[model samples]
Target: MVTVDHLVKDYGTLRAVDGVSFTINKGDILGFLGPNGAGKSTTMKMITGFLTPTSGTVTVDGLDVSKNPIEVKRQIGYLPESSAAYPEMTVVEFLTYVAEARGIRDPEELNSRLADVIVNCHLDSVKYRAIENLSKGYRQRVGVAQAIIHDPKVLILDEPTDGLDPNQKHEVRKLIQAMSKDKAIVLSTHILEEVEAICNRVIIIDQGKVLVDETPAEFKARIPGASIDEVFRDLTKGSALA
Candidate 1:
C-alpha cells in the first residue's frame, strides 16, 4: 500500500533522509525504529506529502505522493508526533471539524464514524469534555481519532504511545492492531516492546539510511538469545554481534 523508492531529503547540505527504500503491503504493521536524528520522521513527512522529497519517489496505493498529493493524502491517515487540536473544542466538535475537512458529507456517516472512533479509542467518558481538560493520553487518543475519522487506506503514526502509562499504552496498541486488519499501518517509535507487541515487520534506520528490514524473529536472531534492544544497538552502532 505504501512504496518509497530511493527517497532522499536534504536541508541545504545536510541529508536528513538518504536513499531510503521500502514497501509496506496491505495488512502489514511496520515498525520504523531509529534513534534521535535518524531521519525517521523526515521520511514519514515525505511519504505523507507534508514535506517534498529532495530526490526519489513515494507512492500511496499507486498514487505518487508528489504528483498526486491530494489523492495520496486522501488515502492516508496521519497521526503526527504532536497532537495539534483546538484546545477549547469538545472532542466531538473537534472530530466533526476533522470529518468536514476530510470531505465527509453524510451526517449519518459522520456521526457513525465519530461514534466508532470514540469507542475504539475509549473516549466515551470524555467525548463531550473540552480537549484541553483531558489528560495527555486522552489528548493523544483524540489525535488518533481525528486521523482515522475518514477511514483512510493507510495509517502513519509517529510516536503514537509517547506519553501513556502501561495500561494506556496496551490499549492504544490494541486499537492499532485492530486497525491493521484492513489498513497498512506504519509507525515510528523508539520502544522495542511496542514493536514486539504489535509489529510483524521491523525496519531499523540510522544516519538517514535503512540498516535492516526483517521480521521480529529475524531481527532478534541477529543477536542470538539477546533482547531486541541488544539487536538494535548491534545493528545501528555497527558492532559485531556475540
Candidate 2:
C-alpha cells in the first residue's frame, strides 16, 4: 500500500535522510527503529507529503506523494513525535474540526466519525474537556484519535505510545493491532518490546540509511539468545559515536 523508493531529504549540506527504500503492504505493521537524528521522522514526513524529498519518491496506493500530495495525504494519517493540538479547544471541538478538514461534511457522518474516534481512543470521559487540561497520556490518545478520525488506509505514527502508562500503552498497542488488518502501518518507536509484540516486520536505520530489514524473528535470530536491544545496539553501535 506504500512504497518508498530511494528517498532522500537534505537540509542544506546536512543530509537527514539518504537513499531510504521500503515497501509496506496492507496488514503489515512495520517497526521503524533508529536512534535520535537517524532520519526516521524525516522519512515519514516525506512519505506523508509534509516534506518534499530532496530526490527519489514516495508513492501511496499508486499515487506519487510529491505529485499528488493531496490525494496521497487523503489515504494516509500521520502522528508526529509530539502530538500538537489547539490547547484551547475541547476534545470534541478539535476532532470535529479535523473531521471536517478531512472532508466529512455531512452532519451525520461527522458525528459518527467523532463518536467512533472518541470511543476508540478512550476519550469518552474527557470528550468535553479542553485539551490543555488533559494529561500527557490522554493527549497522546487525542493525537491518535485525530489521525484515525477519517479511518485512513495508511497510518504513520511516531512514538505512538510515548507518554502512556503501561496499561494505556497496552490499550494503544491493541488498537494498533486491531487496525493493522486493513491498513499499512509504519510505527516508529524506541520501545523494543512494543515492536516485538505488535510489529511483524522491522527496519533499523542509522545515519540516514537502512541497516536491517527483516521480520522480528529473523532479526532476533541474528544474535542467538540476545535480546532485541542487544542486537539493535550491536547493529548501530557505530552511529552512537560522536
Task: Put down candidate 2 lDDT per residue, 71-152, tens digits, no spaces.
Answer: 9989999999998899999999999999999999999999999998899899999999999999999999999999999999
Which candidate number has the best lDDT?
2
Alpha carbon lDDT at 185, candidate 2? 98
Worst 10 residues of 2 by lDDT: 233-242
Q: After superposition, how far is residue 125 of candidate 2 from its true place, in Å?
A: 0.5
Candidate 1, residues 45-129, lDDT tens digits: the string is 9999999999999989999999999999999999999979999999999999999999997989988999999998889999999
Model 1, CA-based lDDT: 0.91
lDDT values of the candidates? Answer: 0.91, 0.94
For model 1, give the RMSD to the true fold: 2.5
- List residue ranges in candidate 1 displaced over 4 A: 238-242
In model 1, how many backbone clashes occur?
A: 0
